[model samples]
Target: MLRKPTLLLAFGIFLIGACANLIWVEPKIYMPGSTEIEVEGHGINGPVDILPRGTTAITISHEITNAGNSPVPAGYQITETVIQWVFQRNIASVGWREGDPATHTIVQLSQSGPALDPGESAVISFGPFTVGSCGLFGETLELDSTNIVVESSNQDNEDKHLFFVPSNQIINITANTINGTLYHKDGRTLTHQFRINSGGAGNQWLYTGFSWIATEGSTADAVPAPTGRVPQGPAPQLINMFVTPKDHDHSPLGFGPSVKGKVTAISTDGCVVKQKAVEVLVEHD
Candidate 1:
């Protein structure tokens, strides 16, 4: 027979051995980082419609989710996650507007706050803030392009499914200077421009005649003078077009309350092809 203390000791040893076996058999997974994150839109661009306005606030939110099969391990942690906007060119050479997002700072979230459990998600809010200058540069002194980026312990967060979509997509044809006011007094002479552009994109041609529509009087009476060609732009990207003043195209308020200018153009088939209307507003001042 065993003494009472001896019996108790033997039972305790059995319990310890059984517990050890149970714990070891259980699977301990060590995937310390997030596996997947959620962004609302497709491509590298956060939202297809988001454009950086000089003063208007724009919001970009990304959901960081733990997509692993198991919880983050005890010893390992995600130190930080970085969010930023980047401007890039097709070629490797750095661009004039390329680098970090100027108006906004790169966001860094510390993982020290809490351990991420598998399947749990956190939404990272970037901005309800506006951006500053677009950093545009062209022969006509216009345009800028930028895209979004998110960085973390995982590279897939920022680079996954990259289409490099632009926040703002400009129309192939753009007008720069109307020169004079939309609303102008009668009998005043003014000068203005319609810019034809192609940075080696293609050959673009206008539909010859540009005309204005007057609300009050006949189109003929509204435009006392006809359209004429105007030359403009910097070297290499220089574009020339048929431009005119509002007074010449649509006289003034006697013709009506307002006037609108309209013309059309078609690009050469081979390069960057498009057929679109070119328009501008000239008011009575």
Candidate 2:
């Protein structure tokens, strides 16, 4: 665990309508000392950088302080405290609700200590817990806590942490002549060769099809067209599809004139669910 600067991004809300005033600071967790990287629109904070599969990036270290002018009053001494998670969508909980299972308490301290003098402080460390890799690679850890707010200083007790993970699938492609013919004579065809590699475990990707923008006067036939749903492979998968045109009369394009096509990978595997995408350029001639 690395020791780095901590962020104190805070917020407060007041409501007098049918609803009530709500004040909260989203919870978050990350590697010991990672950069402040965030994904947009997830929450107040963005996601951190991590691996696609199972990885550990959760940590918590918070301080409790007594900032009163004098020693904490006997009646106002801190009493109960807790640290836990608040699931916004309740995905893991049945009728899934935020803060459900009531048993999800990570830490609870009642009558934790004797009265402390002013300017005193205490430290609490909750975890270095293990988090599995699942779902899209972005937001992951979020932590929330509720403490008896005898002092206004501790009102901010929420932290929404986002764990950022990158794509683990690796793919390589080199443009080659189609049907062993660089230029289509009269009855030859052109094709693009794709060499794909799934780098880590559970990295299977399915080739749904290819999407491209063609100029008005261009005409070419791409193998495994949009309707072709070819399974990518286990790991280090090799595939050949039709798309690139031959160079001039000797180009790979079997039917149309030489054309450079920008290709985006389309898939319907776990890759799609995890928001992983790969793009390549296939040009011949």
Candidate 3:
């Protein structure tokens, strides 16, 4: 007969072995709808440049992983991704403080072009464009995704999945003038001398001429229709000045327009723009 202590020891070993095997065994394959989606990335926060009637480019990227075991279904697709700038006062749990709500606006930065794959990732780029009306100083950037789907080769295995992944980083962009010039069509000449100043909310002050068409008067009256002014005609009032950092540096003058502005100033905490505030929007071509 086996000793009592020996039998107990054997039982203990058996239980441990059973536990180990259970841990190694694969669990039931979860239906796509049954599993959760995961997204990981650094959030965008802080000051972003807002140029009136101008464009700017910004790059956003992140990694998406399939936390669940098993292939996330053969026909799984990632439909859409978007980034928006939000102005809120609550402190983020991820260790970032939201910006003040009084003087800010949320703008959608970019939308994804194509669907993503299971356990796959991508980087999205959007263009240079004006940041419409609202000011965006001390704002917070939020990344989100939508319309995720999971399908399989089998006719009956189609499943729909949808979710969002938010980040904890803020976007900070500064406005700086790259180059400016004035052009005169009538004189057939260009002048590089022009003074530019931040016109608040990304608008700049420059000199330009305005023209209007002359109306016909009663022929019976004095003066012959005032000479040069055509009757209800269209004339070009050339506003010679131009500004930029356009992608290409080509111009009839052998160079592009000039821009005059200061670089974006960062605060000590690096969460807001110093001495400047403006709203921004992301335009994609």
Candidate 4:
């Protein structure tokens, strides 16, 4: 027979072993670092149709699931997700205009305050928020965890997609001054004038007629305009004038020569030209 003390000691050891086994086998969940939480499920839906200067409701839903087995601590808070509007290479957190749904458009479908349990999940819904004209917009979801991951609809399977639209208006061209003896290749000097249309940037222009040559001046810096030979006729014409926004080396509203002309001379003041008598390029507003 075992002594009472020996028996008690044996029982205690057995209990300790059992407890250790339970700890080792029982599913455990650990809190994910701030960087560990990954936000996905944007392009889960296809491209959203947007109207020009109009607002549309869009739903962006995402899921937060615990990949780990351990239960996360209680009372962990998930902050609100943010959507960014990217337009014409510009990004803003706010909507394009007032009453626009796209601006800070966040609708919480579920509470983000509670600590998620192991193998549990959370769902978030944003928008019905307005989106500005047809263009690219990106959404990023952030969490209170140390491991934060951001996902965007523009990104797919590690690839990025761009959303952009062509401007409705065509390019505008303007000649501040045409101070030169415009001569045709046949050596006939003639008078010339330049004009431009008013509108947003990136408009296109079409020219027909005599070939024109254009050069940039110190203050007359402008983009190199497209050139073509003038059609043979009483009136020569050039077609298709393409204009882009002001570039560092180009005009503020887009500038280029509309006629096919030879560079007779270029001085610090301006350029001298010889053309077959080109027509003034037409501007599409």
lDDT of each: 0.30, 0.35, 0.25, 0.30
lDDT of 2 at 13: 20
Model 4 per-residue lDDT tens digits across residues 1-285: 669989999999665443100011111111110111111111212332222222244544445554444444544434333243322111221112112345544333323433455557655444444443433343334443332222112122121111222224333333332433222221222224434332344322322222243343111112223222211112222223222212124346687423333111011111111112233322222
lDDT by residue for model 1 (95-175), tens: 123234353343333332223465665443334433333322111000001111111223323311111112221224444
RMSD of 4: 20.8
Residue pairs clashing, model 1: 182-282, 182-283, 182-284, 183-283, 183-284, 183-285, 184-284, 184-285
State in Å the error of residue 138, model 2. 12
- Kindly report which residue stretches of model 3 are placed more than 4 angstroms away from their true locations once superposed: 1-56, 70-103, 109-118, 128-144, 150-285
Please report the candidate that would top lDDT against the real structure: 2
Predicted structure 1, TM vs. truth? 0.27
Please give the range of 10 consecutive residues that has the lowest summed lDDT in model 4.
Answer: 264-273
Least lDDT summed over 10 consecutive residues: which range in candidate 3?
214-223
Backbone Cα, N, C clashes tallied per candidate: 8, 24, 27, 45
TM-score of every model? 0.27, 0.33, 0.22, 0.27
Q: Can you write out model 3's per-residue Cα lDDT over 1-285, one digit (the tens) per residue?
A: 579989999999665443100011111121111222221111333222322211222222323333222233233332222223342222221112333344433333445333433444333333322233232222122222222333222222221222111122122333232212222222212212222232233321111111111111101111111111111112211122222112222345543332222212221122222221111111111
Runs of candidate 2 with Cα error greater than 4 angstroms are 1-36, 42-53, 56-59, 67-70, 73-116, 128-149, 164-285
RMSD in Å for all candidates? 20.6, 15.4, 22.6, 20.8
Error of 3 at 20 (Å): 26
